[model samples]
Target: MLDYLFAALLGVIEGITEWLPISSTGHLILADEFIHMSTSDAFKEMFDVVIQFGAILAVVVIFWSKLWPFRINRDACGSGVSGLVDRYCRKDVWDMWFHVLVAIVPSAVIGLPLDDWMTEHLHNPPVVSAMLILYGVFFLLMESTVGKRRPQVRRIGQINYRMALFIGLFQFLALVPGTSRSGATILGAMLIGCSRTVAAEFTFFLAVPTMAGASLVKVVKFLADGGGFSGSEVGILLTGCAVAFAVSMLCIRFLMNYVKKHNFKVFGWYRIGLGALVLAYFYLLKPAL
Candidate 1:
């Protein structure tokens, strides 16, 4: 029961932080420091990544119309195969998907090679705190500079192949623990002239494949290393994922509405403050005690 409660709390954290410019993995890591679950280190690690699957489901739910590329058109059915293609296939959505695929390449290429090293060494409070503060400053500076200019890509469709690849390159930077995946790509997109809404939307779309691939990798590695979940562990995992899916629905909606009228400066300040708190707790306050 207590473990389930902890899982729910972490779920809430993941759902909220995953979409925001603030880092979800950073929050989960910090949360783990205090909210120790009665599970092995391996399960805990796998739990953190797989719980994101719930959040991914939320994106699919909210954007199903945009993400799904097929529909039935009876009118075009009579015209044969060419009409079938036109009726059932959404060219725009497919194009968007292709762009998403391109955007994930850089992260896949770089992140795969360094995943183990990073998890072993960099998945610590100090690294997480440093990245939180570093990207926080980047957000502040980015907003003051290119963020003030008129955006060249005001819509997700306006994001060209070059822009998608550039954003994917930035996604590679998120291999660092505290660098939010959404934050890196969104910041990169906005820096290159995408509007805030476009950057946020593209970031959400990009997350579907990026996170799914990452979760699959973690699951495979966990199994390869002889990790197995018990019955209770499965329950805890399900609880976390269910709660994350529910909360993510609300968070994604809120963020979409929030970004239209607001800049990311507030999240920037929040990250810096939270990063300082983590550093103080781990390095200063805890050490003194």
Candidate 2:
């Protein structure tokens, strides 16, 4: 019961933070300091990474129409969950996927090399705090300047290869903890002339592949290392994933509606305050581990 409860709590955190441009990994790391799972350190580490699979699935299901590569056959056009459509030969959708592929390359190239190095040195509260504050400032600055001007590209389809590559370059910054992946891409996209909705939607689309592939790699590596788990541990992992999926669907919908009406400044202020709190808790209130 305790393990299931903890799993559900972690899932709630993941669901709320996952799509909010608010650094879900950073939030989870901080939460783990308080809510230790009844599992091995190895399992806990893998749990945090793999739990993202559930969140990614939310994006896949919620945005299936936009993400599906097929246009419905004229004969098959109907209603809910149109499955009778052509599943292939979607040139426009394929082009969008190509752009998404390009946008993930820089992070894949850079992150693969630095993974161990970052894990060794930068996976601490101090580093996370600094990044949170840094990106908070970045968002506020961008909104004050670039956001006031009318964007050149107001829709995701208007994004070109060069812009996608630039967004990918920005995503490379998210290799650092606390530098939220969606935050980086959204800010990059907005600066490059994507409207608020366009930036957020593109980030959502971009996450489907980037995070799913990442979760798969982590699981594969864990298995390759001869890692094994108890039945109870497996239950905890499943509980977390299932809860996260349910919560993420709600969050993704809320964010989509919220962005259509407001800017991201509230998130910026929240990051700044949270970063300060994390720094203070570690440096002044708590003793070092």
Candidate 3:
């Protein structure tokens, strides 16, 4: 029962930080430091990665109309494969998914080799702290330079594959804990000339595949390592997933609406503050506490 409660708390943390450009990994790590769930270290690590399935599913459910790929308006003009394509999938939507596929390739290629190494070496509070501060600085610097000027790509439709690939390259930076995948992609889109909302929406679309695949891989590895869950552990995981999905729905809606009128510098500042706090907890307060 205590584990179930802790899992719910973690789920709320995951859902809120997961999409807010504040690194979910950083917050989750920090939370675990204090919350102290009675799970093995290995289970906790795998739990953090696999629970992202819930958050990404929120994105999929919210954006189903845009992401369904099979949904199309009926229009009869052409009389061939083009017509069938139009009837089944809108050309631009197909193109958007194609671009998303292209964008994920860089991370997929680079992350595969480094994932094991990073899990072995860099998964720690200090590393997460450094990345949080680093990306926070990036957001502040970017906002200062760009200053919400009229954007070249105001709509997702305006983003070409070239731009998508550029954003994906930026996303590769998120392999570092606390870099925030959405944060990197949003910054990249802005750098390459996308408006705030457009950048964010594209990031949402990008997360579906990226996170889903990542979660699946984590599950596979955990199983291969002969990781087994007791009834309580399984219950905890399910509770976390369900709570994460619910919280993510609200978080996504709030962020989408918030960006229409504001930028992410607030989240940037929040990350910096959280990073500093994490450092303080580990260094200044650990001895006393």
1-289 per-residue lDDT for model 3 (tens digits): 7878989999999999888999887788778777888898778888888788889889989988788777543355444343333445566788889989988988999987799898778779999999999999999998888745778998888888889889999888888888898899999999988988989999999998898888888888888998888898888898999999999999999999999888889988988998899899899999687
Provide the TM-score for each candidate, comma-separated: 0.95, 0.94, 0.92
lDDT of 1 by residue, 57-149 (tens): 999999998998986565666865544434458878898999999999888887799999999999999999999999999999999998889
Q: Report lDDT per candidate.
A: 0.92, 0.88, 0.87
Candidate 2 or 1, higher lDDT? 1
Q: What's model 2's overall lDDT?
A: 0.88
TM-score, cand. 3 vs. native: 0.92
* TM-score order of candidates, top first: 1, 2, 3
Model 2, position 59: C-alpha lDDT score: 91
What does candidate 2's lDDT look like per residue over 215-263, in tens digits? 8777777888888878998899999999999999999999999988898
